[model samples]
Target: MTGTETLERPETADKVEHFDVIIVGAGISGIGSAYHLQEQCPDKSFLVLEKFDSFGGTWHMHKYPGVRSDSDLFTFGYRFKPWMSAPIATADEILKYMGEVIDDNDLAPHIRYSHKIEHAAWSSKDKKWTVDVVRLDTGEKRRFTTNFLWMCQGYYNQEQGYTPEWDGMDKYKGQIVHPQTWPEDLDYKGKKVVLIGSGATAATVVPAMADDTEHLTMVQRSPTYFFPGQNANELADLLRAVEVDPMIIHDIVRRVALFQQQEINRRSVEEPEIVKQELLEGVRAFVGPDFDMDKHLTPKYRPWQQRLAFVPDGDLFKCITDGKVSIETDTIECFTETGLKLSSGKEIEADIIITATGFNLSVLGNIPFEVDGKPVNWPETVTYRGMMFTGVPNLLWVFGYFRASWTLRVDLLGDYVCRLLKHMDEMGVKQVTPTIPDSLSDMKVGNWIQEEDFNPNYLVRSMHVMPKAGNHPDWQHTQDYWREKDEIPALDLDTEALVYS
Candidate 1:
């Protein structure tokens, strides 16, 4: 059988479908990538394979109460699409927006739902990828071949969230749940709940379940930074009042928000004290001066070290002030029959415990990848701007920025990948891989990301499995959108580092 031809067997439910490009996942990154490919590389045949039954990856997976976007929709939404709602949006609203994108672009025809990729094998001789897949809805097996593989499946494992085992966890009779897999039938009304986490998920769930629960207490080992403000955008409102184009309003508001974020990030590095004080003072304003900011709200690290979760209109603080939610900054000692005992000897009684700790990091959707019969070892390979990796040909992974809205990099990488594909066509090459030059072979290498730069628990826990970064800019994923915005567009695709065959 020819490499590009579709093969069918009457005896078995197996077939090999070929495409110019095959994108993994149907989430925000994958959908945005698909739109760019269609618009820029009009002649290239492509397909998007989503393991889930529908679109909206994280939004669809997370169903807990008060689930919402931590980043403002103006910046979080795609640049081509206008998010004409409040700055903060619910999962349903985000899904509706994504649905509109699919409908407007006619992308549904190109997407294959419920197709979970099993193994992806690269053929050096054939200069293509042969993918093994299983239909989740059926027991049918399928095969697909593509000239290029675009991994947009996301960075975390969706099957299970990270819930640390504590002493006597099994002895506790109360129900335990993770926000990633929130059960629809979960009734929290009149229940004494203790949520364990200090991240965005905990902040979201506390206010959402506060009123209904007998009492909700947020137990965090350490405090996290938060930015609380009104959900509405004044600039967008002003533009709407004057009847400006919705598209123009979106662009203007997004740019302004980005600019503001850049300023704060800069201060976090250059003048951390000022930024720290500003953040603390903001919290004091919300919780009132009488509240103990240092004991309950202040974080050990500087601002922007971890994500400063956005709390719309200070709702979390409102919950605290209204006596519906309480914050306990201490470590969990052990679980009791009725509740949890803290390291400080304080016991919290609860009927339900929600672990919003975090998620387990995954590499390439935890798919076993083989290159020319040998398994791909990600840690041994070096990343090319955190997209392409060494020894991996005709493949790219979309790993977005931690500090900025994840969609921003999705849009940026979308353009870069399309251009690279076109350049390959021009060069008469079917394979391309990032190669570490001989001169830099002995240079000091480090973890996937620098701890000092950005160290959330998910990335910290999975650093061992991640690809290494080098001292050079070409071999590094800086995670700086401001610098990368200019650097990526100006990148030389024909450099020697990118070996073409």
Candidate 2:
């Protein structure tokens, strides 16, 4: 078959099959769960359903220029697989690595592409889930039953990125683009560019565009915390020396890297005044003292209140110093015929306007789940061990945090979930769920996420829901790996969970 043609799988076509476990996403988290589940429960049947045609989730969806990982390969990559490439990985290389992971594990046979999960309903009587799905190619509807449901659908749907309505966007003559849905063929070389938003994407794109664009301006409503990307050459060499022993090498490198990162973070917190002064001094040394450091670099919130934008090898700072890129810290009032009109009544002209705003965090596509016809409200529900939702029996959700590599956290969670499943099987328990007692009162927990951070249009229309940080000790706080292994490994797998007679 040619590259563009879809090969027909007549043997596995248009049929519904049941499994012991059903994983909803084919992304890194979902793939990690599938890998662990297959290893733990080789005797049981399991399947992974991917909404898109390919394996890589976000990497496959985003194809803009300078697309790459924000974190270093040592920490961002899979523990089992040694990142043999440079310290930082390009998007194409990352996608290729993801493909290799899926193929090397022989996971292709168990995956069904173009299958989007629509909704899932649980039956208390049977202690199983009946999931409804749609086949994107043939427009066929189907259903499958599974004993356990794992939602690794990730935090955002690529179909929608956060795009706010600008007052006069329609009147603008220049081409408007959202980085998430970047057009592949659109040419930008030698064009005057204006990139909106001060997040990671903007940080990566501004410097990349400066290489060819006539001029580039990064417009931000507020400042985002920036940090120099500390991808070390020594770490890569060390990993190469111990490549044969992946686990030991991963542990060693991860520990050292985490230590360095935490030390930097600690200094920022413990010696704020000194660190701030040092940072300001560095900025002045890079740019002139006349440069507006407060307007461009000073963040209103504390460091890591959100994620800090990483600049690989000081590329962003270099671009600013070279006068190739400029930062404009003003509220965008509206879109003009030629470019953007700021609140200060000043106009910035551009041939192309790219919106790199952010993303909408969706916990399992905000799908309304029903167990025995009783609807489950997820935001009101507490997260159990930060993996499973309260009252959602036999269901597990995997999510990463702003502090660590998404895959690393999810990998640990996946292993813990598999262990839980194994313990359940040994105990002959059929279903498990967290029961919140009335005696305990709920309180606001972490400020990792806030309502203002999310786009109302996207959240209300799409599948976007935030899980509550649990009120109890078991449910509250995300303490890194050691604490997680202790709590989750000893969790009451044999609790008052249901068992078939």
- lDDT leader: 1
lDDT of 2 by residue, 222-312 (tens): 8776766444557657667755466666667777876776765666667766666665565556667778989888877655546666677
Candidate 1 structure quality by residue, lDDT tens digits, 52-157: 9999999988899989999999989999999899999999999999999999999999999999987888999999999888888996888899999999999999
Q: Residue 6: error of model 2 in Å? A: 37
State each model's C-alpha RMSD to the native: 3.7, 6.3
In candidate 1, what residue range of length 10 has the lowest lDDT sum? 1-10
True-structure lDDT of candidate 1: 0.91
lDDT for 310 in candidate 1 is: 90
Off by over 4 Å in 2: 1-15, 238-247, 265-269, 274-290, 438-464, 477-486, 490-501
Clashing pairs in 2: 365-463
Cα distance off (Å), candidate 2, residue 34: 1.4
Backbone collision tally, model 1:
0
